[model samples]
Target: MKVKAIRVHKIGGPEVLTWEEVEIGEPSEGEIRIKNKAIGVNYVDIYYRTGLHQEPLPFVPGKEAVGVVSAVGPGVTGIEVGDVVGYADTPMGTYTEEQIIPATLAIPIPPSVDHITAASVLLKGMTTYVLVKQAFKIQAGHTVLVHAAAGGVGSLLCQWANALGATVIGTVSTQEKAIQAAEDGCHHVIIYTEEDFVAQVAEITSRKGVHVVYDAVGKDTFKGSMECLMPRGCMISYGQCSGRPDPVPVSDLASKSLILGRPGMRHYTATRDELLHAAGEVFAGVAAGVLRVRVNHVYPLHEAARAHADLEARRTSGSVVLLPAMPAADS
Candidate 1:
């Protein structure tokens, strides 16, 4: 079968994302060929397109997707043809209508969920899953501050943190986004553009700062996020959407006995077992309604450029996905 995919031929602007027809090959041993229904578009995709997280050029440019298995190769014991599966991985080929995925990375998608939601949660949802469940082990009554409260990671973080009984202080750039963040699970939404987040957190916590700060905004919010934390509190810098934060002086951590971390989904889900474990929690979170995946916008597979443009300009408020093609068959 022929598949249409968005490829980045050169490293530069969104215009570099080109739609091209490619041949779909059979899965090799231990692999499954998937007919992708939904492909996720996230801020990380923008970083790849702009050469921020450098990759070998002229390849497919996405890491998350959900689809039905069209075929399975030998030695793949856990998966079979016709299974609903999804993955978030390093190959960066999920932008295609169909892809050959290693069975190790493919997790069975429960029938309770739809493809769009599955794709939306695969990476970001899993990140939040690991962050709350493993990274800092959020507990009841802990106070947390989440930067970019309406972005992909931020939205998921708010929901998971609140469900874990943490009081969430989410920071957003505008009133509309602040409202959206509150709807997601933020106990308190701070419009960082209009007010000072550090002062707000200080007031909200009655001078006893939060236990942790989930900061993906990086350069713009790092210092402020750190200040919002209590003594020995953790600051998890997982992404650089606002550009990478500058180097910190180690002396800074000494004053607070701070626990600084830079966690990545890749690190959290490095082994197949870890991937399955995290995917299971993510899947259960979605199925149980404890977590919500919001697709704020979707673009045709060929419109990846416009999609990247929208995300980079901060026009998108929640998770975004790319519909590779209309679903042709149900699994």
Candidate 2:
């Protein structure tokens, strides 16, 4: 079958995202073919497109999507045709109308969650789950500082941490986003563009600093994020949205007794059991109303280039998704 998708022919700007038709054959053993309903647009997708994360040329750029199984390959068990399923942290090529994915990677989406919500949250939600639950083990009375608080993962992190009885201080680039962060459960929202986040964190935490700093804006905020942490505090730098963080000196950690970690979702969800456990926590949070999946932007699959531009320019607030089955009028 031939499927429409956004293929990256070269590593460059959003223009490199080219809409093309690609042929796909039947899934081999232990694989299932899915017809995508909605596709996720994430900063990692931008990294892949801009060569920040190296990849083979002329490959699909998406990493997450939600769809329905149209055909199940031989030896696949527990998943039948027509099951609503979603997958994240998988290999690229999810930018298509249909795809063949390993059955182990395809997870069953709860019937209560629609395709758009599932696609928007699966990757970001799972990442937030691992960060707050596994990486830092946020608990009552803990204080957390989340950079880019209005973003997909940041917003979820703020809400989840707050619900866990932690004090949440978030940083944003604009006043509008500050308001958004506050609504997302941030007790204190610092406009980083207009103020120094490190100074603000000092004042907010009464100079003791936070228990942890969740930083995704790398180069621009790395030093300040370290300053916002208390002694023996953990700094989780999971992404380099601004740019890769500057190398840290080992002596720096010794000064404050701080611990620095760079975690990846792949490692957090390496085993099948780990994948299900993390994903289950995310779903439970959403179901229990502690975590809300906000899909602030939606675009047609073919307009992926425009979507990337919007996301990179910081025009988007929460999760952004692409609808593969969008009608011509919407496009």
Candidate 3:
């Protein structure tokens, strides 16, 4: 079948993303064909599209989506046509209306969770779970600092950390996003545009500093994030939206005896059981109203170029979802 998708032949700016028809074949052994219901827009997708991440020439660039299984190929089990499933951190090529994915990557979506919600949160929510539960182990009384806290993964981090009884301090670029961060459970929101975040975190923590700093902003915020960490604190650098940060010298970390981790969902949930465990927690959090997905940005899949542009400009907050475009009316 020929379907509409965003394809990248050469990496560059958002303009490189082309909405065109691509042919898809039936799934082979151990693979399932998915007719996508909704797709996620993430910073990682931008990375691949911008050459920050390397890939073979000519490819579809997307990592998360929720869909219905339309065909189950040979050797597949426990999944069938008509089942609603969601997958994140999978092999790229989910930018289209339909795709073929490994059976092992599929996670059953609960009936209570809507497709858009599932698409928006799976990748980001799992990343948040790993950051809080595995990377640093947030606790009650622990002070947490989340950079880009108005963002997709950042918002979930704020909410989850707060629910875990931590004092959450978040940083955003604008006052509007600061308000959004506050509503996401940030006890204190810092508009980095007006105030120095390092100074603000120092004041918020009574000069003691935070136990952990979630710094995804990279080049611009990395050094500042390090300064905001308490001695023996943890720093989780999972992204580089602005640009890659300079490598830290051992002596720098020695000054504070700090622990640094760069955890990715792929490593945290490499096994099937691990994937299910992380995904299960995320879904449960949503069902319990603990993780509020701010699907604040929604666009048709064909408008992906515009979506990328808006995301890179920081005009989007929380989760950004791309729905499959409607079929053109017969003319």
Candidate 4:
């Protein structure tokens, strides 16, 4: 079948994201074909578009989407045709109208969760689940500092950490984002554009600092994030949105008795069971109102380039999703 998709012929800017028709063959053994309803837009996609994260040329640059199973491959059981499913773990090629993915990676979306919500939260929420619950357990009374708290994953992290009975301190660029962060369950919000986040964190924590510092902004916040952590506290550096952080010196950790981890979803969801467990927790959180999935921007699938530009420019907040069913519009 020929389906519309955004293909990257070369790694460069958002303009490199080209919308074209591509052929998709039938699902092979242990694979399933999905007709995407909603596709997620994330910084990782931007990494793929540029040369930051290397991938083969002329490939689709999306890792997350929610869709319905159009066909099931031979020997695939438990997942049937017409099941509403979402996937974050991948073989790439998700920026399309339909995709063929491994059945093991396809997670069945609950009836209560809509396709938009699933696309918006599956990847981000699962990341938060592993970061707050698995990477560094956020116990009650713990204090956590989340950089980019108004961002897609950061917003969810703030809420989930707060729900765990931890004190959530978030850093955002604008006052508007500061307000949004507070509403998203942040106990304290720091406007990093005007204030020194490291100093603010110190003041908030009474000069002691937090139990854990989740720094996804990478290069820009890496050094400061270390300063915001208490002795023996963990620094979870999962992303490099600002740019890859400088290599940490072993002596630095020794000096502060600090722990640093750069974890990825692959490690957290190494098995199908682990993937389901993390995704299930995220879905449950959304259903129980413990976490809110916000879709702040929506675009037609072909407008992915514009979406990427907005994201890279920091013009968007909350989650952004692409509607594959909608027709492409002029830029």
Give the number of the best model, judged by lDDT: 3
> Among these predicted structures, which one has the highest TM-score?
2
Of candidate 1, the 10-residue stretch with the lowest lDDT total is: 322-331
Instruction: Kindly indicate the candidate among 2 and 4 with the higher TM-score.
Output: 2
The Cα local distance difference test for each model comes to 0.88, 0.93, 0.94, 0.93
What TM-score does prediction 3 earn? Answer: 0.97
Q: Which stretches of candidate 3 lie over 4 Å from their true place?
A: 326-331
Clashing pairs in model 1, backbone N/Cα/C closer than 3 A: none
Model 1 vs. true fold: TM: 0.95
Residue range 179-222, candidate 2, lDDT tens digits: 98999999999999999999999998899999999999999999
Worst 10 residues of 3 by lDDT: 320-329
Worst 10 residues of 4 by lDDT: 321-330
Clashing pairs in 3: none
| Cα-based lDDT at residue 206, candidate 2 | 92
lDDT per residue, candidate 1, 1-331, as tens digits?
8888888888998999999998888998888899989998878887888888888878888999999999999888978788999989666888998999788888888888898989998899988987898889999999999999899889999999999999999998889998899999999999988999999999999989999999888899898888888998999988888899989998899988999999888888889898888999988888788888888898788888898888888888888888966545687
Give lDDT tens digits, candidate 4, residues 178-245.
99999999999999999999889999899998999999899999999999889999999988999999
* Candidate 1 segments whose C-alpha is farther than 4 A from its true place: 326-331
